[model samples]
Target: MADENAVIVNVLDLPIEWRHNITPYHEVRDPDLVQQLRASMEAHGWQGPPLVCDRDLYEVNQDQAYTGSHRIVAWALAQDDPSADMPCVFIQDIGEHYSIDLGELVEENFGNTYAAVEQFVALLPSDVAEAYGLDNG
Candidate 1:
């Protein structure tokens, strides 16, 4: 659980260096979606803070995001001000009892929803697929 007293920080101040790859595979970027998000943010502003976890228990003093990566990216791409501040909810002092394994967490969070798999497969070269043994047909 996060501390009830979490403070808002500048988006540039976010500890992105400590970020973990919480997704099982790369997600294809959608320019249209990015544009939509940008327009939304420009018109309505930020809806909420991104959820950030304290990595101090994992021997790192930085915070990592277990969620809201896309929102963060959208903010970066959309915001005109480089030093723009955004609200962030920080999970304070999480220890082993509250720890989640990365792989399991990714699986639980994303659930293998490869909605763009066909699009991805279409872009792969045949020799590349065969090299990776992914040439099913």
Candidate 2:
């Protein structure tokens, strides 16, 4: 579950100099997947927010993306309209949270990364989910 205490912030409202500090554990985003995400945003707009760490955690003023770098990029590319806000969950103390080990949960639930992706993709809109070859069922 998403943290109830998360501070919602518009992605574009973040400091211009603040970089997206992606963790080493995160997979390198596939270009094809990014394109699909861009297309999805263009067609139906962003569905959910990404998890980002507070800027105070970094000495260089970087915002750590706990998840959703692709979505952020796709949002910016699909629409640069200032009024289009991408409300992201900005967590202040992610280290203190118990929900960080997604790998363990994913392995327990689906037994593999590919299955986990499909399962999550199914949560999106019907058409978007179908594009990824997964049904809501």
Residue 125 in model 1: shift from native, Å? 44
Deviating ranges (above 4 Å) for candidate 2: 1-28, 81-85, 93-137
Name the top lDDT candidate: 2
> Taking the tens digit of each residue's C-alpha lDDT, what string does model 2 give over 43-92?
77655434443343346644544456555566556665422334443332
Q: How close is candidate 2 to the true structure, as a TM-score?
A: 0.42
List TM-score per model, in order.
0.38, 0.42
Model 1 / residue 69 / CA error / Å:
1.4
lDDT of 1: 0.40
The clash number for model 1 is 0
TM-score of 1: 0.38
Q: Give the alpha carbon lDDT tens digit for every residue of 1-137 in model 1.
A: 22233233323243322233222122425667667766777766655444343344345543444335455455555566433344443332111213423334335546432322223333445553343222332
Off by over 4 Å in 1: 1-29, 55-62, 81-83, 93-137
The local distance difference test score of model 2 is 0.45
